[model samples]
Target: MVVVDVQNDFCEGGALAVAGGAAVAEGITRYLREHRAAYDVVAATQDWHIDPGPHFSDHPDFVTSWPVHCVAGTPGAELHPGLDTTGIDELFHKGEYADGYSGFEAHACGTGDAGAASSAASSAAGRPRDLARWLTDHGIEAIDVVGIATDHCVRATALDGARAGFAVTVLTDLTAGVAPDATERALAELADAGVTITDSGTPS
Candidate 1:
């Protein structure tokens, strides 16, 4: 399962607050606690934007860029307080040097090429592990996705999962969106692309 960007910066009272983002975080935590055994590897993605760049613009276009949020070492960068991350096997960070919406863009701590990510991030151990590589290493053929901003990160992650040849399912109930119309449109687009759309009650 993939939990995408359930951070404080996307939750209520955050700089880029998405409606019900906090509730989604709580819901995902509960789901993991209850259904963790249903999956083999449970991973999460975080928008760990560190430096000040175009992604953290003073005047964001809201389409291609956003406000300063999820900066490294800041409260906004941490996951929501209500989220229980006990079962999370891996935590991938993205948006450190550029604009990143898809969870696939994140690199697992200690794995991959390690590129320009800070030493503090690499201190977690392991190499860089992108979502595709990680899933492939684990022999994952399908993925269930949930998280904040259904219209954005969730959408991008699910689409990328599908593109990566995984059977992708978006857990609608466990996700919240920044905009209703955009979320609806995104869901439609995913469906058209052959991604499954289901709620928690539905069997995987």
Candidate 2:
């Protein structure tokens, strides 16, 4: 299972707060606590931006890059307070240099490339093996993704998971979107790409 960016920055009161982010955090914690056994290996991704380049623009344009957020070593970069990560097997950090919306852009810890780089270009160039290889190595054939901002990171993760040939499902109730219209469009896009959209309360 993949839990997409549930970081504080995406939640309420953070720099780039998304709607219902806090509720998503709490719900995910509860779901994991009750259904941890349903998943084989659980992993999570966070927007661990470490550099303030084009990804953090002075003038705002929320579509690409808007405000500075999820900077490395800051509290906003951490997971939401309501979320319990005890069951997570690994953590992948992304957006260290560029605008990383997909978990695949992240590198798992213990890899040499998992840290703040001197520059955004260097960090992108230094990215280690992607999430696909890691999933394949661990024999993960399917992925259930749940998290904040359904219109952005969650959408990207699910699409990438599908592209990698993994059966992907986005737990609708476990996600919060930045905007309702965009979220609807993102869901439609995912369905068009063959990703399943469903509520987490129901069984697959």
Candidate 3:
């Protein structure tokens, strides 16, 4: 499955915008056009948050707190208009609470509750309707991931996919970096975790 976070808040001029974020959507569309029937499914993840969620406040772990972004019902939360989402079968929303950097721990997984079942289910749920679970549920194992902001959501989803036992391949050309440095770090981390990173021009 191809997970694209082409949300307005991550694109240029929006809250928490990433550099060169807009271009990722074009790359993803191109890839999908070429590989539409090669895979059984295609999905996207959206950072759908509500105002005053925990992520807005300053936290010591982060360099600085970000302004309200990806708020529900706001323009910033919508997917980029340029993306052709016709083939996408699912839209998973994450970050309903403060500090929602990872799509794997979104409210869809029941991460907010403290019960043991919730925690187990959260862990089992992996990323919100993640590629691995979707594949396994349908008796598949391979997945190709493509999306925006390689440094954060993309990286987290890829890494978690590998850990969840899916044969994960990240399409490098279909992704944009949050920053050069963070992108480099995420690539290193993903490589160390056994993810196969390849350019879009290469065969999956």
- Residue-level lDDT of model 2, residues 42-71, one tens digit each, is 888988887747878888788887799999
- Write the candidate numbers in order of decreasing lDDT: 1, 2, 3
lDDT of 1: 0.84
* Candidate 1 lDDT over residue span 81-134, tens digit each: 888877877788887887778999988764223333423444554455577887
Tell me the TM-score of each prediction against the true structure.
Answer: 0.88, 0.88, 0.79
What are the lDDT scores of the predictions, listed in order? 0.84, 0.84, 0.70
Native RMSD of candidate 3 (Å):
6.4
lDDT of 2 at 126: 76
Give candidate 1's error at residue 8 in angstroms: 0.5
